[model samples]
Target: MSATAISTDVYTQVQQFYARQMHALDACRFDEYAATFTEDGEFSHTPGRPAAHTRDGIARELRAFHEERFATEPVQRRHWFNMIHLIEAPDGSLRSTFYVLVVTSRPGERQPEIAPSCVVHDVLIRADGGLLNRSRRVEHDYLLDLKRT
Candidate 1:
């Protein structure tokens, strides 16, 4: 495939991967959510939080964190992506940068708070079947009380 075509293909695959991930989270499918990444993939929150290196590690940590943090109340979370820029690296890996708006709705809340809207920088490797996320970094523009704590 041409360079342009390869980039487009990779972009589409990554977009689908992200959509599935969001779907898993929205549907409260914690296991599936954790399965979206590679075995050695890393997910980083904002500036200070340490990156989780493996799916099992992240799942265990996030399960505890989410239950403790959100078990008291119900909330809805949605992640929206825009302006995705993809580049094919020399080693056949792909790098993508995009903007994401995460909105969370709380019970009895008048309006859902749109927060953590920022740029997402990611590196993905083309595997045998599909794209595997090698690294993901989320840079939040602003933080808000989106999740009910």
Candidate 2:
């Protein structure tokens, strides 16, 4: 195959990996979400929010927060990714930016509340089997509406 084709394939793989990651999160599959990262991967909502600098760190933080905050609540989250832009790095890795819209709803809610759509900047490292997310930075576009049910 040609070089361009190979690069396209790699990009597509990375995109699909990201899609699956979002799916896992939407499904509340936290373990799977944790598995999407590398051992020392980093996932951060923003600069001020707590950052998960490793797979174990992410799992710990997420599990603890979920247990404490939503122990008795039932909610669903859905993420939509769009405007994906990818570029091949010098070492054949991939760098990508995309826009994401997340909506959260409770079981009896009349309407799902949409979180501020954000731009995600990410670095994907190509590994032996596939691509792994080395880092992810999320930039929220608006202030969070914190009025709780």
- Which candidate number would show the highest lDDT if scored against the true structure? 2
lDDT of model 1 at position 31: 71
Q: Candidate 2 residues 1-149, lDDT tens each? A: 11222466766787789789988877767778888888899888744558887888877777776677567988787888898888776676677889998888899888998876898988888776877888888888775565889
Tens-digit lDDT string for candidate 1 (1-149): 22434546656788898888888877777678777778888888655667787988767766766687679988888889889888777788778889998888998998998877788898888787877778888877765446766
Which TM-score value belongs to model 1?
Answer: 0.82
- What is the model-wide C-alpha lDDT for candidate 1? 0.78
* lDDT (0 to 1) per candidate: 0.78, 0.78
Alpha-carbon RMSD, candidate 2: 6.4
Error of 2 at 21 (Å): 0.9
> Candidate 1: which stretches are off by over 4 Å?
1-7, 143-149
Candidate 2 TM-score to native:
0.81
TM-scores, in order shown?
0.82, 0.81
Clashes of each: 0, 0
Residue-level lDDT for 19 in candidate 2:
81
Error of 2 at 40 (Å): 0.8
